[model samples]
Target: MGILALQGAFIEHTKMLHRLGVDSFEIRQKKDLLLPMDGIILPGGESTTMFKLLNDLDMTTTIKELIQNGLPTFGTCAGMLLLAKTVDNYHSDFLGTMNIAVKKNAYGRQLGSFRTTGTFASTQNVPFVFIRAPHVTEYGDTVEVLSIVNDKIVAVREHNQLATAFHPELTTDTSIHQYFIDMCQQ
Candidate 1:
C-alpha cells in the first residue's frame, strides 16, 4: 500500500497500517507512486495545499490515472475532499475521481470539532471524530453510503474508492483500516 505523505496526518496513517500488519510506503514523489501497490490512502490535510503540491510534483495526473485503472483509495477528511467530484466554494482543481459533492468545513470551524458513535456497514457504535470535516451532499449511482450523521452522508464507497468525512486514524479503532486492507486483498 502507498500513503500520500505530502502533508497532514500521514504518520498516523502509517502507524495504523503497521498495526494492521500491512506493509505501506510513504508517497513523496510522482515516481514513488508508479509501483505495484494494492491500495493507497490520502491522509487528512489541507486540500488546497496538498493539491498544489501534487500538481507541483506532477503526481496529480498519475494519481487520476491509477484511480481510473482500479486502484483502491481511502481518503479521510481533506483527503475526502480531494476525491470528491466537486467542492463547494473551492477551486475546481481537484482529483475529482469520486462522484460526490463535498461541502468543505460543513460542520463549522475547527473549534466545532465533535465526536459521535455511528454504525458503518456491520460495525455499530463506531466512534468518529470530525474536525473541520466535509459533508457529502450528493453521490453518483455507483457510490454507496457506508455511514451517515444527522441525515448527511459522512462515509461512502464508490467502486474501489472509500472516503470518510471523519478521521478514523485519529481514533484507536482499527476496523475501518482493516476493512480497507480487506479491500486491498480483493
Candidate 2:
C-alpha cells in the first residue's frame, strides 16, 4: 500500500497500517509513484495544499491515471475532498474521479469539530473523528452510501474508490482501514 505523505495526518495512517501488519510506504515525491502499490491512502490534511503539491511535484496526472485505472484507493477527510468530483462552490476538481459532490467544512470550521460513534458499513460503534470535515451532498447512482451522520453523508464507496469525511486514522478502530484492506485484497 502507498500512502500520500505530501501533507496531513499521514503518520497516523502509517502507524495504523503497521498495527494491522500491513506493509505500507509513503509517496513523498514523483519517483515514489513508480513503486508498485496494491492500494493508495490519501490521508487527512489541507486539501488545497495537497492538491497544489501534487501538481508542483508533477505527480497529479500519474496518480490520477493510477486511480482511474482501477487502483484501490481510500481517502479520508481532506483526502475525501481531493477525490470528490465537485466540492460545492469550489472550482476545479482534484482527482475528480469519484462522482460525488461535497461541502467542504460542512460541519463548520475547526471550532465545530467533534467526535461521535456511528454505523459504518457493516460495522457498528465505529469511532469517527471529524475535523473540519466535508459531507456528501450528491453522488452518482454507482456510488454506495456507507454511512451517514445526522442525515448527512459521511462515507461512500464507488468501485475501486472509498471515501470518508471523517478521520478514521485518528481513532483506535480499524474497521474502516480493514475494509479498505479487504478491498485491496480483492
Candidate 3:
C-alpha cells in the first residue's frame, strides 16, 4: 500500500497498516508513483493544500489515472473530498473518479469534531472520528452506501474505491483498514 504523505494523519495510517502486518510506503513525489503498489490510502488533511501540492509536484495526473484504472484506494476525510466528483464549496472537482457529491464541512468546523460508534456495512458499532468531515449528499447508482451518521452519508464504496468521512485510522479498530486490504487482495 502507498499512502499519500503530503499532509494529514498519514503516520496514523502507517501504524494501522503495520499492525495488520501489511508493508506500506509513503508517496511524496512524482517519482514515488513508479513504485509497485497494489493499493493507496489518501489520509485526512487539508484538501486544498494537498491538491495544490499534488498539482505543483506534477503528480496529480498519474495518481488520478491509477485510481481510475481500478487501483484499490481508501480515502478518509479531506481525502474523500479529493475523490469526490462534486464538492459543495469548490468550483471544480478533484480526481473526480467517485460519483459522489460532498458537502464540505457538513459536520461544522474543527471545534465540531467528535467521536461516535456507527454501523458500517455488515460491521456493527464501528468507531467513527469526524473532524471537519465532508458527508456525501448524493451518489451514483453504482455507489454502495456503507455507513451513515445523523442521517448524513459518511461512508461509501464504488468499485475499487472506498471512502469515509470519518478517520478510522484515529481509532484502534482495524476492520476498516482490513476491509481495504481485502479489496486490494481481490
lDDT of the candidates, in the order given: 0.93, 0.95, 0.95
Q: How many clashes does each candidate structure show, in the order listed?
A: 0, 0, 0
**Residue-wise C-alpha lDDT for candidate 1, range 64-147, written one tens digit per residue:** 999989999999999999999999867666999999999999999989999998998689988899999998988999999999
- TM for every model, in the order presented, reads 0.98, 0.99, 0.98
lDDT of 3 by residue, 42-111 (tens): 9999999999999999999999999998999999998999999999877865888899999999978889
* Clashes by residue pair, model 3: none
Which regions of candidate 1 deviate over 4 angstroms?
none
User: What TM-score does structure 2 among the candidates reach?
Assistant: 0.99
Better lDDT candidate (1, 2): 2
Flag clash pairs in model 1. none
Residues 29-146 of candidate 2 have per-residue lDDT tens digits of 9999999999999999999999999999999999999999999999999999999999996887688989999999999889999999999998999999999999999999999999
Rank candidates by lDDT, best first. 2, 3, 1
Please give the RMSD to the true structure for each candidate, in Å: 0.8, 0.6, 0.7
Candidate 1 lDDT (Cα, 0 to 1): 0.93
